[model samples]
Target: MPAEVDLKRYSKRFANLKSKKETPLTARIQIVGIGDDGLDGLTGQARQLIKNATVLVGPSLLLDKIGNTDSKRIVVGSNLQQLQQAIKELGDSSAVVLASGDPLFYGIARYLTETFGKDRFEVIPHVSSMQLAFARVKESWDDAYLTNLATQPLDRVVDNIRTAELVGLFTTESITPAVVAEALLDRRIDYFTGYVCENLGTPDETVTQGDLQSIRTQSFGSMNVMVLVRRHGAADRPSGSAQRRLFGNPDDLFLQSRPKRGLLTPSEVRCIALAELSLTPTSVVWDVGAGSGSLAIEAAAIANKGKVFAIEMDAEDFALMIENAKMFDVPSLVPIHGQAPEAWKELPDANAIFVGGSGRIVPELVSSAIKRLTSGGRIVVNVSSPDNLVAVQQVLGDAAMQPDVRMINIARGQYQLDRVRFASLNPTFLVLGQK
Candidate 1:
């Protein structure tokens, strides 16, 4: 049959179907993921679904690749609104929508499901190009950070790449592997081995591997996936101190002990706690329970000319704190390797103190530390539980110091497969009082 004859027959049937007054049965839309290999890449069940579909819908590129089909075809472009209207006009016709790779992973399936409803469509996924790219490079993607350039800003993606161990990116024509490589180098992030997999699952498939500097100088096919693997044991290179802020640096910049990485106070919470302390250039500060010395190091940076002592009971954490202080070049920061109170017994009274820990003895520690606080100095205690918050508040109340209490709830935005989602941090309670 001629292509025009098929279109006319399809149009007339669609018109007659739409003119009926009675509502038709719910449309069955099968969204099938295809690769560059076209029908050859599809499974038996997926190919059968396409053959049985009464109406076919997809972008021109994908529709062109499918060749001849008995189903009536609707060519969709970037205009999704038109696609939705066309699907609606089908009026209960079984339609098959073709997409590239795994439609759910940064593909069109999410848009279709969101536009219609979950019950209206069934999704059959093919191997995503990201997965193929990782496979080509012989790397695991389970823990890799994956995202699309179409949805996220390049600068934000570069920042995220700075701290990630592995990354898989869906590249657009305008934002190719070369463009991403340039952005990373501009930010002084040069520890990754880059791989650009092009035309995956096809006869013309090619995988290009190079360093960021080399990748930045080369061009690649529009259909490509960019994968970055951090070089083994490569530590993150810090930006020049002149460009760094006095406080609120990214948490990744600090070296943290494994298995207890969450022990460090989050950067957002650290900023708030530091503000509450209100230290001066010449003020003395103490960080009690300073796991990894995040708070004490930032404090030393703020009080550049002042002394900041970080007290930790864990030997490993204490060593990490010392290394972190050196990493940030904060000569004024001191690491005390002992339990608090006893650790600070020989040190001078501090103008500001930050206590961060949980347990029944936290309140007692706060009570004892306050006596060593200089007159007119502030003490800020950060606890994760309500019980500790109340206990610390009661201790301040007994010392005749009215404490200002705050509960901080923080949620950070992170890129998932296709979109950005918020991940909430554990809530923290901060109690600040003056001696």
Candidate 2:
């Protein structure tokens, strides 16, 4: 009896020693991405992590892999608010969350980290469905225009795809391949071949390839990415040779007001304003006196996810800006209908500023806009008359340094019986200032 008691104590002491030598473990949230193949396809580390988890949280499709649901589990569906509540209530419990592909790549990792902080969790990722689709098609996706159709508007996604060699999209209940194909065809963008990769990484995975017009006629599964490769010499080699054009695209392409014709801020002026703005992909811009929102719309396109406020005093021009934004497929333009200075009061500090029109209120507007601009923000003003141009230059020069001003005169070629005539547009002055 005494010998047995001594052996038990010795065993307990050895167990404590072994635990102390091993790495420390804690209660944490593990976000894992799984493919369609299910359990048999999970990595060894992923499998062990799931089996040892005290609490599991995921969608129904992922929950099926556990084989036993007796453990404390939370089923997540489309309710992000509910998911957040569930996670918050989990307090002190070790949690294992299941997601669809790489959690960090448009998955739950961002939300979890944002809500619970990065130190509170660990991520175990699987092959992303997009990666699998690209693999199935035997193509590298390093430069592919990738975005989730679930979160982005159809027009924005289509516009981004318009200029890309390949596109990978995470689709949802509404935006499918047929719908996407129809959109591209409607835009007269029929110069490319299309491919749809569906149910990738699973046994029933399939890849379908056809021209944009041909693909429009067929239907595809829910999980898919519409890939496009431009055909040889498709339409006029796209405006410029990728070096980035400084000015003058087709005027009809922009959103312009009806009765008040030629209200669009010309492309030349727009380029100069953008240059003065010194825009980055994330700079927030405010286009005061935004006529037809030409400057604001282009600024939004250049600043991708950044925000742009298109403040216009005219109702007709405001509506036209909305139409133009939809046509350009730029999502960052926020159209605000009101007079400047007063309208800009509620907006966040702007990184760049653009003021247009030859109105007498130019000086006051410039002063008000400068106050709201962040440090080092650039401002550009456009004027049509020499008088207004001189006024703007004086105002800007007094507030900051010697302003850089330019006179822009553009002429388009028109075909005649035996020659080309120079059809001239309006001449304008662009004044750039900084604070």
Candidate 3:
């Protein structure tokens, strides 16, 4: 039969079938995932769903690749609202949405599930292109940071990539692999090996590997995934975000209320406190009494992959910490407004903890936090008074191994009209213990 004749016959058959069926059929939606293998790769269930679908919706590439199924096809254009309207018009007809790879991982299924309820979709997920990209690069992506350029912009994704060991990105034609390489080099991040995997799961699949400078001029196909593997022994970024320090950032650089500025942990003390905790790239940390979030923000930067909870009871301090965290551009820092012991009830066990305060209750907070620390976990406490020092030391020393104690006395330089002056901050005591 001629191709046009077959299409006409199928359309007539579909019209007659629709007339016979009841109006508004409550058919289940089949969100099917396909790869480069096309229809041959689909499971028996997925194949049947696509074959019997009353209506089909998907990207143009997928529709072209799937060939002819004779179903009422609707191309999902760049405008998602149009697709939503089409699906709404379909009523409850069988909708077999053709998608590539696992639709849930940065795919169309998220939007569909959101637009229509989850109960409407029966998603058949396939091997994600991200997984294939990592497998081709022979890297473990369990700890790798994964994101998509189609939804998330480069700036937001790049910040999270600073401290990541491995990064897998879904690249678009406009924001190609080369664009990402240039962005990384522009930020002075030169310690990663970039790989571009194109036409994944197909016979023409290719993986290109190079440094940022080498990949800067290359253009890749529209369908590609970019992977970045950080070179061993390389720091997250050279100077910690253009002008800020990775940790122990100056107290004044943070956004703080005038009266609480003096109460916040000093840069000198934070430096020592951070060093005592012995942070790693993926360590769960907690900052009790996280005033202005100075300590919590630094911890979040160091442990970018891990979670950091800044537990502060004071409403003013909690609010200040949130603002300061944003100022520092640390996304992993979570501000908890409630008091500790209770606030930390639902939090994960901490690999490192920092407690800052000079009140008599500092000892009690330290004791409670120590109880929640993981084995071999370290805790650092900073106090300004002898009474707090003695009390915290006693409490920590009793619950942990013998504590390491230090007294930090800091001074800053000042020059006015060819004259030099030295200003001194109040002395503080740092007590560190390992559980």
Candidate 4:
């Protein structure tokens, strides 16, 4: 018995030493893209590869769908480390990894190929679920914004969806069609016709369609894709329902009681001022001396995810500004019915500042607001008189690339007896300072 035990110990030591000296596995992995239809959906070549595989690795759901395979199978889950360790341990074993839809389209193929050598694997792709969803909806997806809910936060995704003509989303278990529908409705984005496609390519497959309000109340199967199609002639904003003009909306769209008319910024100047602000989607803007909130309202629309504070002392203009914001469905615009320099004391620092006034105080207000602007922030001021313009430019300082100054002289087109005439507007000076 003692002699037999010694012989076994010697044999184990020899095997261990041999394993340490041997090279790592060079076996190639076959990654097959399969649909919900399982093996029935795979091509003949893919089926043969799986049949010949010595080891198979995939999600348990996919593995179950491809049941009774003669190959040794390893189930992959959320644990990426486990998957990598399993592959490393499968030395000299030819393996096949199955994934859903197009393997490279937000699937396991990209991860696997990155972890292992790309040259060590072969990929066979099927139609992606996102493609299938758009196809089922009969929509062209060339320019459509596509995102995966599993990867991106729904809040940030909703902002992009606001302006997107078409959006295709891959739904996750926690963030489902119902959650997305509710989010859209909450943002007052009601123009899209929502589609929920579930269990695609399977016998129990279903495609559900409804408006945002209707879809908000519904549930869906775990495996699904949600698509949103913005209706024809729909503006990129809910405010478009009331104020449909793209950028420099007409001043008449705003409610300026009796004598306050013509106090709002002209469409031409509004466009110029907005462009100079260099605003992003989440830029915080301050429109001081905001009469009827024309520039502030438009800025709020452009910075969809940002906040805009419209500071006006006039009660009538302040009320008008509030009404105009709601009229344009601009939920991000906050009407501050007090004077500036003090009204903005408690508000957050701004990214872009817009000061509009014909008086001397306009330049000083712009100067004070500039102090509150964040680094790399922008400030644009529109002064009607030449003195205020020069004073504003002086406060902005004269760096080589510092301030941008422009004189805006606009004219309105009019027709009299089929003859065209132009009505000239007073010359206004604009100074844009970047800090």
Query: Deviation in angstroms for 85 in model 3?
Result: 0.5
Give one digit per residue, the lDDT tens place, for model 2 in 1-435: 454467788999999998786655445788888887777778998988888878889998789865784467899986889889888887777778899878888788888898878988899999888887777767788877777777777876666565456677777757777788888777666767777888777778788988877787888877666666666534311221223322344454654443355657767666666777899889999989887776787788888879999999998778777776776777888999998888988899999988888788887898778788788888888888898888888887778756888899988664322235786889988888778
Expressed as tens digits, the lDDT of each residue in 49-73 for candidate 1 is 9999988899988987878989999
**Which candidate achieves the best lDDT against the true structure?**
1
Please rank every candidate by lDDT, starting with the best: 1, 4, 3, 2
Name the 10 consecutive residues with the lowest summed lDDT in model 4.
Answer: 234-243
Predicted candidate 4 versus true structure: per-residue lDDT over 245-353, tens digit per residue: 6578865456655434566798899999999999888999999989878899989998889998889999877877787788778888888988878999999999999
Best by TM-score: 1
Q: What lDDT score is found at residue 186 in candidate 2?
A: 71
| Candidate with better TM-score, 1 vs 2 | 1
Query: What residue runs in model 4 are displaced by over 4 Å at the alpha carbon?
Result: 1-25, 238-435
Worst ten-residue run, lDDT, model 3? 233-242
TM-score between model 2 and native: 0.52
Task: Flag the better candidate by TM-score, 1 or 3.
Answer: 1
Model 1: CA > 4 A from native: 1-22, 92-94, 236-263, 276-278, 288-294, 297-305, 309-347, 355-409, 418-420, 427-435
For candidate 1, the TM-score is 0.73
- Candidate 3 residues 110-165, lDDT tens each? 88998888988889987889999999999998878787787776886776566567
Cα TM-score per model: 0.73, 0.52, 0.56, 0.56
Off by over 4 Å in 3: 1-25, 239-392, 395-435
